[model samples]
Target: MPHNSIPVIETKRLVLRGPEAGDYPDFRATFSSYRSRFMGGPLTPYETWMLYAAEIGHWQIRGYGMWMIHDRTTDKPLGMAGGWKPAQWPEAEIAWIIWPETAGHGYALEATHAARGYLYGRLGWEGAVSYLDPKNLDSIRLAERLGAKKDTGAQTVDGNDICYRHPSPAQLKNTQISDGIELEIAHYADPKFRPEGYALD
Candidate 1:
């Protein structure tokens, strides 16, 4: 797919689509708070704007980057989730950051599962890793739940970080629906890209 035609991924309760200019407020909020501490945040608005722009630019340059996660039912942006591989990174990585209000609702797990599926199944990636800060226990636990094992020998651009290797495509569990939750992947060429099973309208 062309860089502008980046795919949209949907999960039971969330829709993962390309970042928009409007999402900057929420994105900035997350980065400016203590919640962003692990992700190298607590930055000034200008810095946050630069980071946000880089996220949008990543798709143009790298062909893949983070998606703006939105609540499927309410169309409210939650945060971002998708593949991240900067020039200084060791390998392609699946990363996620849920907004404070949505932090404990399992949105990250659901959205990430869909993101990884797109990365491995659709993108033909052999595998990907998540570079996590040592003190980010929440992320570490989430990685464990996603079947990512600690790759102690892996090296990261930041010496203090550790790598969590995700399971291969064959090993990923099918996205199971529970409590009426569903997942969908959007195609760039389709104007009617929204999938059924969720009230995105």
Candidate 2:
């Protein structure tokens, strides 16, 4: 698919869409902190810029990549959440990162659930995994809540991250949008690959 045609996903409280240049400030702020320790950060400004550029490039090259998450109400960028599969990855992975101030309100869980739904429902993926740093307790907990279990046999390219395998579409349960919340998938007529009929919930 053409990069510009990347789909935008929406949920009750957030929008998961393609990365934009405007998201750089939040990206820089998040990665410049110690919170980024597990995400290859505390990077130099130039490096951060390159990382942002790489995120954009990833979508162009892989058809599916991370989405720039936004607070639907405030229309502000919150962080990123979606599928990722760099060259050396064992499988496509579901990933998320929320800005520090926005932490703990279930945004990660909400966005990730929506992203994983898109991957499985809209994209017909059998499953996905999350490469998590064992020390990142919060992520571990979130992965567990999302029904992802550590795949003891799997390893990352860097050899340090543990893989958490997510449930397949058939295993997902109770994922309906709650009252006052909406989930929208952007329409794209000529996607490189048409999705087979699959529903996450």
Candidate 3:
């Protein structure tokens, strides 16, 4: 069996860490907003708890999960980005979401690029996928921005939503991928891999 080699991911304005038990309130608040309902339901408190629990489980079971996004300056929680592999997906999925306040600021792209770098270059994951709703123009644009192509033949995870497949060699130019993190690739490829709290420990 392989060891868990996943490292915590960070961005210029955010920290992507594994979800903890205390994230329910923020998760509930974020997920319940109108901004979030377009992609998925605005979950109830219990539902938010369950979701975070599953996210943590993803890290434990699959070695990666939806990361808890925190503000780099104030350390306030913001949103999430990382890899997900539900029982039904064909490949590991790259997922991201930002609070409404954090929207339009490029947080999603930033966190996502970093997460992809870790998953592919460090963890040796070659195939990463993303599921998007056709109606969510913002997400589609982000997918294209990240070089993900629309998968016309891809099946939806739920009864709704279309799937988008990211090109293996795709790289977003404007998004920042930090150097000082403690991951294998960060230590080797990035000069700043362990920047501040960005360390894996």
> What 10-residue stretch in candidate 3 is worst by lDDT?
173-182
Q: Please write out the lDDT profile of model 3 over residues 1-201, one tens digit for every residue.
A: 112344666665667777766766777777776767765667776776777778777777777777777777887777788888879786678988877776655567667777887787878776677988778788777777667888878767885777888766434323331221223333323455423432121
Clashing pairs for model 2 are: 12-182
lDDT of 2 at 24: 90
lDDT tens readout by residue for model 2, 70-93: 888888988789988888788899
Residue 162 Cα positional deviation in candidate 2, in Å, after optimal superposition: 0.8
TM-score of predicted model 3?
0.77
After superposition, candidate 3 runs with Cα above 4 Å error: 1-6, 170-201
TM-score of each model, in listed order? 0.84, 0.84, 0.77
Give the distance in Å from residue 184's predicted Cα in candidate 2 to where it truly belongs.
20
Q: Candidate 2: lDDT of 184?
A: 24
Candidate 1 Cα errors over 4 Å, as ranges: 1-4, 173-201
lDDT of 1 by residue, 73-143 (tens): 99999888899988889899999998888765567777887788788888899989999998988888778
Q: Specify the highest-lDDT model's number.
A: 1
